[model samples]
Each structure stands twice: as C-alpha cells, then as structure tokens.
Target: MKHKQAGLSLIGLLIVAVLLAFVFLIGMRTVPVVTEYFAVKKIIHAIAASNPSMDETTADIRRDFDKRASAEYVDSVTGQDLAVYKHGGQFEIGIEYSRKIPIVANVSLLLEFQTDAKSNGGR
Candidate 1:
C-alpha cells in the first residue's frame, strides 16, 4: 500500500517560514511610507476643503500647510515643497516627492508620490 504525505516536511516548513519572514520584513520597512502617504493625502484634503483659502494668497496657503504639517505629522514634505495652482476657478495643491527606503545591505526601495488636492471636491 502507498500513502501520500499528510503534512509539510521540515524543509518545506522552513522554506515557508523564510518566505513569510521576508515578506514581513519588507512590510515592516514599507509601513512608514504607506502611513505617511495617507497622512499627506489627509492633510491635502483638509487644506483643500477650506473654502476661503480658495482665494488666499500663496503665502497664506503655505502658512496653512506649515501649520497643518505640524498637526498632521507630515515630516517629509514641507509647505515650500508644495506647488499651488489655480484650476477651473478653484485652488489646487500639487506635490511630487520621493522617498528612499533601505531594504538590505545592497537593496533599497524608492517610492515616488505624486498627488494633487483640488478645492472642488475632486481628487
């Protein structure tokens, strides 16, 4: 009589464990970038939603961004990093930046984020 293997062997389990660990490490390294991206989106939306600022000057807009940056915990990009544009009679804030994350001795990850915040409820 012949029987099939019922479960994973030691080598099979070890391979699986190693793969899981590699994934976990990559996730750990990327977590901060993901979190900060959302934080940036939130800050942009908040600033864009402020209706009165639609007509505000660039200096005022930058000032508000600086304030929001502190409150929102967005450390990567500053108000000076923002580019303001007027689109379709509404104000838009555009940001383009990149972050480099170290993965290992010779490997790294580069993430680039490009986003715009429009005051007219457009993403």
Candidate 2:
C-alpha cells in the first residue's frame, strides 16, 4: 500500500514562519524612517506652495522649514541641510539625507534618500 502526502510539512512551515518574522522585523524597523521622509517632502511642498512669490530669502525659508520640521518631528535632516535656490523666478528646495537602521546584532541597513520640491510644482 502507498500513502499520500500533504502540502507544507511542519518543518517547512516553521522555516517559512521564521523568514516572515525576519522580514516583518526589518519592516518594523524601517517604516518610521520612510514615513518621515514623506512627511519632510510634504512639508517642503507646502512651504513652496505657500510662498509662491519666491521672494523669501534663504534664511527666511530655512527658518520656516525648521519650524515646520520640528512640529513634524523630523530629525534626520534639518533646514540648514536643505539646498534652497531660486531659478526662473521659481523657488526650489532639495534635501539629501541618509538613515542607518539596525536590524540584528552587528547587522544594519543604510538608506539614502534625495528629494526636491518646487514652488507650485508637483514633486
């Protein structure tokens, strides 16, 4: 007589579960930074849109950005790190920053993001 087999043996299921947990751990560690990046971008866009005249000096813009960033709890990048410029009578703001996240012991992840926003222009 012959016997039949089923899908996903106990060992296989355990392995899959472990892999999933590892991935979830990584996600849990990285999600906050990613969301913060988006928040920073949104803030920049909002500032650009609000000051369409592009007459604000770089210092003024940086101060405004610092205020908003602090309110939003953005610590990775600061207003001083921003490249504030005007071109063709339009205001543009750009930021470059890196975040290092620790996954497991002695193993870490490094993420680098570069984002820019223009006055009254879609990012």
User: Would you list the C-alpha lDDT of every candidate in the order shown?
Assistant: 0.83, 0.88
Error of 1 at 12 (Å): 1.6
Per-residue accuracy of model 1 over 1-123 as CA lDDT, tens digit each: 899879999999999999999899999988988898888878877788875344577778888888988887888999899898876668888788999988889899999998887787333
Q: State every prediction's TM-score relative to the real structure.
A: 0.86, 0.88
lDDT of 1 at 60: 83
> Cα lDDT for residue 73, model 1?
81
* Whole-structure CA lDDT of model 1: 0.83
Clashes by residue pair, model 1:
none
Worst 10 residues of 2 by lDDT: 114-123
Over the stretch 57-77, how does candidate 2's per-residue lDDT look in tens digits? 788888998999999999988
lDDT of 2 at 101: 97
User: Can you give the lDDT of residue 61 in candidate 1?
Assistant: 80
